[model samples]
Target: MKLRAPISTAVAISFGLLVLLGIFIPDLADFRNRILNWAMLLAALALLLGLFNLAQVHWQRVRGREATVYSAALLVTMAITFAVTLLQGSDSANAEWIFNYVVVPIETSLMAVLAISLTLAAARVFQQRTELMNMVFIVTLLLLLVGAGPLFGVELPYFTRVINPYINNVLALGAMRGLLIGVALGTITTGVRILIGADRPYGA
Candidate 1:
């Protein structure tokens, strides 16, 4: 028999109660706020666990005489980043500059490099299937790109008139409503499962 069943049921019930109370009882607002704060604290603790795991892996690689250089670099980068933030404080000019100048540029460059692979994949798809489907795909992509481009230039009034309403009202609102419904359903299902002792993620 699976030990997870009982734990899952209890967690599901607790989560469900929290959600219902949060929505229906104005007096429970403070309790809900505290729970959110506790969640953030838990997330920070999880991050510490991840940092510890990373350090352990790098230390083993360096000490075992395997991939020492890469391991060393990882350790050095972690140390420097941690020290800079801790010493200068996150709100300080130096820390902000380091984040904006170094991290943002690296992230943007990596994203740009990844975009090239996407472009190549699109080309391959067109080459393999040069049919109506490919034409639809290319046209949809062009419309999306042009719609998102700078609005100050020459206006394609016809394209905008046709696409803008569908995209804004249909696509955006549909996505948001779908997401909310999914969250609500998921919460209810999890609550029911936990109440019945069947959906535990924790060892409890």
Candidate 2:
């Protein structure tokens, strides 16, 4: 066990360097692709393990004497969904129906709830803090919500047609881009750390 750590670390760093070098070297691309495919298989296995762990936890809850309805429902739904998807294939009409009817509605409902929750949270913050950032957040949220559709069946041209598009296309787009840039930088930093053996999430 003690000897294994250095070996693992060395293997990890070697693979990392190879993958990085493969980008500019055409000859190494095939090797890189092979390594990536192996990584992907590992990732899929990890995901399967995660699902099993989740189901086990929920199953435990379902077996317990207290408040088990939600857990039972979740387990049943997951089992049914997994079985159907596996049998029918993801592109099958049954799977498509399940996705469209079940998944879409659930996602839409969750989004609606999230929007309302965010607005309420913003309002609470504004009420308590009365800070400039909080005020801006609430005002921006209100404007976006009001501008989303016609109010009382009356279209507000200034908001719906103008401000809504501007906020969504310009301000929101810029913010999203900035976030993506930050994420990319963070990913690079993490990869570098892993390569240098500064971070060993793989128990190296």
Candidate 3:
């Protein structure tokens, strides 16, 4: 009774697997859509729980004066975003304006900063001459960056016509697709582990 976690996990896994098998099992089709809707509702609830948890943690940090300014900014951003979302009713012009101006620019700036940081780190790795993989990585990185940008790819009419297309479309796209597939597989594996009670965060 004290350690029946595996049994509980097994029961939950069996129920979920039966629902999931509805995709291929014709007999389960009647319940499939209902089960999926329930799953989606649960997922939405989980997201709200996450947001509340985030707010709580940041509020605590603000009260403690640990990185108070950043925590305050985060809370303010969340409040404004939430208020706008509710007031504008999701599809309204004001909601779109907030998303386009406030959210998009912040996200774009973060991505730009990330790219610059990665480029600098790659450059530093190249300077060390430590491993063959580092050189290969740097070469691939440079090709993708240049081939995707106007600096060398689009500006040069020849590259825009031939070289850039081959590098960006054929090579880079193929690599990215492969990476996405790997990520999907990894996600499936983790989900399976959770179902099987092999990954037991709930027990903790």
Per-model TM against the reference: 0.72, 0.78, 0.75
Report RMSD (Å) for each prediction in the order shown: 3.9, 3.3, 3.6
By lDDT, the better pick of 1 and 2 is 2
**Candidate 2 stretches greater than 4 Å from native:** 1-4, 64-66, 140-180
Order of candidate numbers by lDDT, starting with the best? 2, 3, 1
Name the runs in model 3 displaced over 4 angstroms: 143-191
| lDDT leader | 2
Q: Between candidates 2 and 3, which one is better according to lDDT?
A: 2
Instruction: Pick the winner on TM-score between candidates 1 and 2.
Output: 2
Residues 10-47 of candidate 3 have per-residue lDDT tens digits of: 76687668777987999898787788888899999999
What lDDT tens digits, residue by residue, belong to model 1 across residues 1-204? 655456456656676578668878998888877887887898899998999899999999999989999999899878888888999899888778879998899999999999999989888887798799798787776676677645678777656766855766787689889999999999878767655556555655
The TM-score of candidate 3 is: 0.75
Give lDDT tens digits, candidate 2, residues 61-162. Answer: 877845599888888888988988999999988888889999999999999999899868876897899878878878888899899899999888899999
lDDT of each: 0.80, 0.89, 0.82
Candidate that scores best on TM-score: 2
